[model samples]
Target: MVRVTSMAMASLLSHITSLSLPLKPHLFLFSHSPKPTRTLSFSTPAISQNPDRNVPSSFNEDIGPYLSCSMPHNNRRLKVAVLLSGGVDSSVALRLLHAAGHSCTAFYLKIWFQEGFENFWSECPWEEDLNYAKAVCNQVDVPLEVVHLTDEYWENVVSYIIEQYRCGRTPNPDILCNTRIKFGVFIDAISSMEFDFVASGHYAKVVHPSGDQIHKDSALELSQDTVKDQTYFLSHLSQDQLKRLIFPLGCLSKDKVRKLAMEFDLPNKERKDSQGICFLGKIRFSDFIGRHIGEKEGVILEAETGDFLGKHRGFWFYTIGQRQGLRLPGGPWYVVEKDVKNNVVFVSRNYFSVDKRRRLFHVASLKWLQGLPPNQMSQLQCKVRHGPGFCNCTIIIEHGEDGNEDVAVVHLSEDDQGLAAGQFVAFYQGRTCLGSGVILESWDDQGFSVCAKALENARMEDKSLLGKPVKIKVKPETVATESCQLDGMVLSNQRPCKLST
Candidate 1:
C-alpha cells in the first residue's frame, strides 16, 4: 500500500498556511492496497465567500459521495483517459485521478481551424493550451497524447453550425460539439485503447448503476455547482456515451475547484476560464460568419410601420431577440423576426409588449438518455439556454408525418424572450437530466402575420404619399424638446407623426 507520508502532509499544510487559506486539517485521506483503493474526504465545509451567490447546502458535502463509478473499487485499478483543455478545472481533474491511484493518460484534442483559415486561426491559443496541458501531465507523471480531430470537427460540428445560421436559426454549437466531437468521435478514436472510461472537467455528475440496480441505465445529474452545471450541453449525449464518462469536478463548486488548483499548484492555476465557442478561441463570431457566408446588403424594417430603419450586412447575421448591434435611433430596438427570402430583418421597439407570449414551442430530433421519454410528460423543467435557470414546462407528444412520436410540444409556465429554432432545450426532473431536443419552431403568439400585413399597408401608404406635400403640426414649445434628427431622418417623440418621404 502507498500512503502520503507525514512529512508530505506537513509540507502541504505549510503551503496552505502560507497562502492564508481557511482549510481544516486532515482534508484528504488515501488508502491504497495491492489493488489501489482510495478515498478523498474533506472535513472542512465549503462556504461561498460571495454571499450573493445561491449555493445549495450540498456544496459542503465531500467528494466521495459523487465519485460513483469513476473511482477504483474492490482492488481494481482503472485506466482513465482524461481530456485536458489547459484550463484550471481539467488540470485539477487530472491531478485528482492521478492521486487516486488510477493509471491516467491525458489527451489534448486539437480541433482548431486549418492553416489556410489563418485569418480565423490567428487568435486561437491552441499552442498555449497544449503547452499547459503538457506541463500538467508532466507534473503528474502521466503520458500525454495529442489527438487531432480537426477534420471530424469541421465536417460534423462546424458545418452544422454554418448551415443552421444560413437557414436563419440559432444553433447551439457547444451542444453539438459535445455530442458529435468530444464524446462521439473522440470516443471512437480511443475505442481500441482499452481505456475503462473517458473523463473531462465537465461540471456534471454521472450515476452508473450498481448493486441491485445494475440493470438500470446510467443517469446524468446536476452538479453541486448549479451556476456552472454543464448538463445542458451534455443532454444530447447517448446512453452509451453517458456510461463511459466520468466528471471529477461534479460535486465541487468553482470556488472549491479553484482552491484545489491552488493546493495542487497546477501549471494552469491562474488561467482564466475559456468563454464563447469552444473551437473559435478569441475570434469574433461575426468575423467567422462573414468569412464563410460573405455578407449581402439587406434592409432593416420596422415590424409595425415597415419604415426603412437602416441597412444590415445580412439577415443571417442576426438572431431572434438579439438586441445588440442594431444601432437604431429613437429607442432601443430588438430583432423580432427575419424574412429570409427577402433578406429583410424586422425590428421593434416594443419587443416585450404584453401581446408577445413566447410560452409555446415545438421540439424535434429528441435524444433521451434512457432510450425512452419520461413517463410523466405533463410535468418537467427545461432550460432554453445554458445557465442557472429552469422553466416549469409541460410536454405534449406529437406524431410526425410518418406517425412516429418524434415531436414534443413544450409549453412553458412563463414567457421567454430568447426562444429560437435550432436551439437545444435540455429537460430535467429535479436533479436528473432527462435529455434534450432541438427546437423546431418558436410559436409567434404576437400576431406576426398581422404585423406583416400592417407593414404591407404602410408600404402602400408610403407609395401614395410620395411626391405629395406633407404638413406637420407640432407644438411650438415642444418642437425643440421632442424632435431629433437621426441619420438625416426626422423622428418625433409624440404620437401621430409623419416623416418627409
Candidate 2:
C-alpha cells in the first residue's frame, strides 16, 4: 500500500482548484483554510484478505442450464465456441446452445493465478474447473477443447495491469483483458479453429444482425437485468468483435438462469459464483499487486486542512471516492485523492469542496463508438460512473495548448467532485450508448481534458439516419422549468420550435 505526506500535498492540491458551481453548504464543516503542511495518519487492512476461503469450488460440473437454448444458423450450423469458466452462467449458456442443435465447443482459458491463491480455488481446483467444462461437454455430448492461454494472458493482461499501475492509472484489467486477450487472442484462435461465432455469458444485447459497421446502427442495448448488465466493462470491444459474438444470457435474469440450471441438473447447477479478480480469485486485488508494486506508508490527511487523519498502506491500492478501510477517528472518511509519486491519501467527510471559481477535468485516450456531430456530443448525457442517473453536459471541444494534436478538452455543464485521471467517461443518449473515453486529466475547474484516440472509433456517420424521425421524451423538469411554445420548437433533432420564456 502507498501513503501521502505534507511535501506531496501541493501536487494533489495543484490539480484541484475551486469550481463555479455552488456545493453543499456543510462542505466547510471542517477546516476552512487550505493547510498543505498538516499531516494525517491511518491504518489499513491487510491487502490479501479473502472473503470466500471455505466456499466450495463450483467447477467440475455440467454447464448446460446457464445458457440460452437458441439454435445456431441452420445452413452453417454456426459452429460456435463458448468461453466456459466452470461458472454457472457460462455452463448454462453451453447447455442452451447444445440443446439448440448448434455445433458447440467449450474453450476454457487457463491463466496464471497468484501464488497461494489455491485456498480460494478449493474443492474446484483449476483442473476441476476445466474438468467441469468437460463434464458439460459429456452431458451435452459436444466436443470440449481446453486451450492453455497462460503465456498470452501474462504478456497481455498481467503486463498491462502492471504497466497501468506503474503509471498511476487504475486500469480496469477485466475490460482490457476481455478486449485484448479473451476476445482478441482467444477469439483469434477460435477464428482459425473455423468457429463461426464466439459465445459468452455476458448480459448485453447487440442489435441489428446485419448492415451496420459502428453498431450504433446495430446498437448494443442493455440486458433485461439492468443490475447484472456487464456492458460497462465491455464497451471497449470493437464492432467487428461484437459481430461474431453471442451472448446467450443477454435476455435472461440471474434468477431465471439459476432455475434453468436446476432444471438441467448440471453438476455445478447449485455451485456458487466466482468473485473477486477474474483469474486471481478470492485474493484481494491490492494484496495481489502489492507484492509486485512495493508499498510504503504515507500520510492520510483531511482535504480541508492538511490535518493528519491516519496512515495508509499504499496510494495505488485505493481509488477516489472509496469509503472503506480508512480507520479514521471520525465516524467514516472518504478518499478524495491519491498522491502516487509522493504517497498520500486525501480524506474528507461528506462536505469539503473548495469554492474557488476554477476547476479541471480530463479524459485520456478517448474513443468514440459513433461519429456523432460535435453538436450532438455536446448536447447528450455524460456519466462518469456506473450510477443509474446522468448529468446534462455541454462539451466544448478544443485543441490542447501544448499543441499536442491528439489532445482535446470537454467542458462539463457542472463541476463534478471525486474526478480521477484514469477512470472512464461514457457518453449516452437515453437508453442508447453513444460511446466512451478515458480520463486524461481532472481538475476543480477548467472542465476535463480528453484524448482523441477513441473519439475517432466512436464516430457514427450514416446519412440514412440524418432524416429519420426520433421521438423526444423530455424529463418533467425540462418541461416544468421552461414554458413550451410549440410555434418554433425542436424535438429530438426536429427543428422550428419557439418557446416563450
Candidate 3:
C-alpha cells in the first residue's frame, strides 16, 4: 500500500507565523529568512524491505482511528490513481503514497486553455507542466498516463464559465471544474480500469458522514492545513466520488509537503505554487474575461450622485464589490450594481452606500451531498465565495410551485456583503463540507438584483423573472423535498423520489 511522507527539515525552524495572518501554511518552523540549501536523502522502500510497513509517526497517531489499517484491500495493495498537477503539492503527494507501499499510477489531465491569446497574454504552461509531471513520475518509479480532456473540459466547465460572464453573473469556474471535470468526467474514463480509488494533492479530508459514522453519506472535510484547505472547491462533489478518493497530503501542512519534496528529492520541489486559474497560467482575471466577453465599453457612474466616474469595459467584466483594477481616478471604488440593458456600472466610495448589510438570499440548482441534509431548517456555516471565509447561516428549504424541492433560502446569521448570482455558496457544518448551490438571487433593504431581469435584465437568460422580489420569503412553511438516493444507500427515507415508469 502507498504511504505519505512530509516534512524533513534537518532542524526545526526559529519562528512561526501568526494564525490570524492570511498567508499560505508553512511547515518549516523558522524565521521568515531563507535557509541554506540542505540535501535531502531517503532510502527507497521496496516491497521486500517491509511487507507490512508501519506508518510514520510524524503523520500523527490520531489518523490511525480514522484511517485504520483494516481496509478492504486486506491482502493486496490498493491500486491508486494519482493526479499529478505539476506542482509542489502533487509532486510530493506521489512520493508519500508510493512510500506507503500502495501500487500507484500517475495521470496528467491536459485541459483546454486559450493559448492563442498568447500574443496579448503569455502562453499557458501545459507543455511545461506535462514535462514536470513526467519527471516526477520517473523519480517516483511510477508509470505515467496522459489523458487529453480538452474537449470535455471546454464543453462542460469552460463553456459554463464564459456563458455566466456573458450573461452578467459572477461564476466560480473552479467549482464547476472540480465537480464536473476532475471527479465527474474523469471517473467515467476510469470506469473500465481496475483502480480502487483516485488520489489528489488537494488539502482536504474525506471523512465518515459524521464523526464516528462512516455509513453512507460521508463527505469531504477541511484539512488540518487550514491555510491551504481546498474543501471549498470540492463542495459540489458527490458521496460516490468521496468514497473513491483520498487526499494524501490533506493532513500535512504546505510547508511540510514542500520540505518532503526536497527530502525525497522529488522533481518540481522548488516549483512555485500555481496561481490564478489552474490551466490559465498567469493572465489577469479581467483580461481573461475580456478575451471571451469582448470589450463592451460602458459608462462608470458614481452611485451617490450619478457622476460619471470613467469609461469602463462592459459591465459584465465587473462583479459586485470589486475594488481592484478599476483604473478610475480620484480614488478606489467598489462595484455596487450593474445596469445590463443600458450598459452601465455603478460604483461607490462607501461599501454600504447602495444597501445595508444583507443576511438573506435565494439559491437555485441546489445539489446536496447524499441528497438534501435532513430537511429540518437549521444553522450551518457557509462561504459565498472561495475567499470570503465562512459565516453562520440558517438555510430554509424552498419548493417550487409544483411541490418539488426547488431552491434554498439562506439567511446569514451574521451580516455579509457582495452576494452575487452565478456564484456558488458552499455549506459547511464545522469542518465537514456538506454541499453547494448557485445563487439565484440575493436581497436586502437595497433594491439591487444580481440575476433578476425585472430590475434591468442583469442575467440574460431566456425566462424572465420580472417583478419577482429578490429577497426570498423566510416564513418557514412546509416545502416539498426532492428524493436523493444511490444503489448502495438511501440519502433520506422521508421522501421517496418517484421513478419514471
Task: TM-score each candidate.
Answer: 0.77, 0.67, 0.73
Best by lDDT: 1
Q: Rank the candidates by TM-score, best first.
A: 1, 3, 2
* Whole-model alpha-carbon lDDT for candidate 3: 0.61
Q: Candidate 2 residues 81-101, lDDT tens each?
A: 888888888988877776656
Model 3: residue 273 alpha-carbon error in angstroms:
0.6
Model 2: runs farther than 4 Å from truth? 1-76, 113-125, 211-217, 351-360, 370-375, 382-396, 399-418, 446-501
Model 1 C-alpha RMSD vs. true structure (Å) is 15.5
Ranking by lDDT: 1, 3, 2
For model 1, residues 1-501, the per-residue Cα lDDT tens digits are: 224323312222111100111121111111111211212111111122433221123334344544644442334677998998899988888877776677888878888755567565667799899888877766656776666667667766676677777878777778877877688767765665678889999999888776467678989998888878899999988898898898988888899889877767676888899877877777777888888898987767777766666778998888876766887755556677787766778777665555766778888778899999999987788887776778888998876666443678898887665566777889989889999987764464543332755356334433333233223223233222232211111212211112101
Q: Where does candidate 2 have its weakest 10-residue lDDT segment?
A: 486-495
Candidate number of the best TM-score: 1
1 or 2, which is superior by lDDT?
A: 1
State the lDDT at 93 in candidate 2.
81
